[model samples]
Target: MEYFQHEWLERNLNWFEGVSKLIPSTNNALESFNRVIKDENTLRERLPLSRVVVVLINTWSLQYTANAKTVHAVPTLNLGLWTKAYQWATEKKKKIVSHVNSEGYVYFIPAGQSNEVTDLEETLNASFSTFEEFKTVAFSIWTTTIPNDSNKWIEGTCNCPGFFKKLICKHVVGIAIRLKYANPPAEAKSVPIGAKRRRGRPSKARQALLVQ
Candidate 1:
């Protein structure tokens, strides 16, 4: 146990402790974006650099225009873990209400010491304004570990025993929820309205209509 704590856990898991909530903990979003790019007809096979550039530019331009139209709207959270984490936080809110009221934060009890309840870490706490304060609660739990190089929680160290066994815990969910609300990625650049059209020959359908 000591070896695991000092040699492996301490060395790897703590790297992004503080900043993990500020950015995505997984590369799923980037992977989805790459998938979209590859799905495009222009990118499905090997192509010349010039053709790839044209396709990329056209795709990006269209995306920029679409994003600009909805830039002010609230974005939805679609990550599966985030939804589960928010639900867990909700279920546990009543159990932690008194601590939150007295200490001004939620306490993280170690898995082995779940029943003792008194020796709480002063610095490690979760904060939320209301039962619906999902992001705040999640941030508090996610940033509990000391910052180190691994920047992830692969095992359980909290009162949530599932974590140590390398399962998802509510605390992790909370962090994911917080990240979903707090540090959304930047929107694509907006294209100007009324931009000049790209020059191209009329389409075959249009040519047929003209001939008719």
Candidate 2:
């Protein structure tokens, strides 16, 4: 258990808090692309080492990169983030402690609300489906700053983990909404707040695999 925690659960593998190391906890992107190559180009066949290299070097990589990824004509707000901003703004529950300093308008946002995971026993017992869900219950007080010119709320820096990873957080967005600096799109209101990743592996039939 100690070995696993130090190796896999720590920064070398999983970024639990991930403040400085703003990277994903899982190597899902590389693993997903590996699946694509194995199933599509290799035809799920155990080829000779030389043959595999030839296919990868001659065909797979070139074919995959033939087309560029989709590029939006204009920069757009992430739907999920917009949804969270809307939810935080609409709820109007959490109290924001604000004051003016030499730098900017400093707001101390209490991120933790009364929720589950009261004790270590309860935390251990709970079957959290995903890391995101497990981490949804935050207890930290995020220090957020919006410049004197409220129009620059988007430039706010937040001490929260979300801001560190994505360069934006609910605290900044919530304050921006309150200060009339930004607004969530209309679609945000309809988005389901409690959405979670589908539990368990997808059915084999749904999974893309080449079978001889």
Total clashing residue pairs per candidate?
11, 0
lDDT scores for all predictions?
0.42, 0.64
Residue 29's lDDT in candidate 2: 57
Model 2 / residue 137 / CA error / Å? 13
List residue ranges in candidate 1 displaced over 4 A: 1-19, 41-43, 68-94, 97-116, 122-212
Off by over 4 Å in 2: 1-16, 19-21, 48-50, 57-66, 70-81, 98-107, 114-138, 143-183, 190-212
**Angstrom error at residue 149, model 1:** 32
In model 1, how many backbone clashes occur? Answer: 11
Consecutive 10-residue window with the lowest summed lDDT within model 1? 184-193
User: What is every candidate's alpha-carbon RMSD to the true fold?
Assistant: 18.2, 13.4
Q: Compared to the true structure, candidate 2 yields what TM-score?
A: 0.47
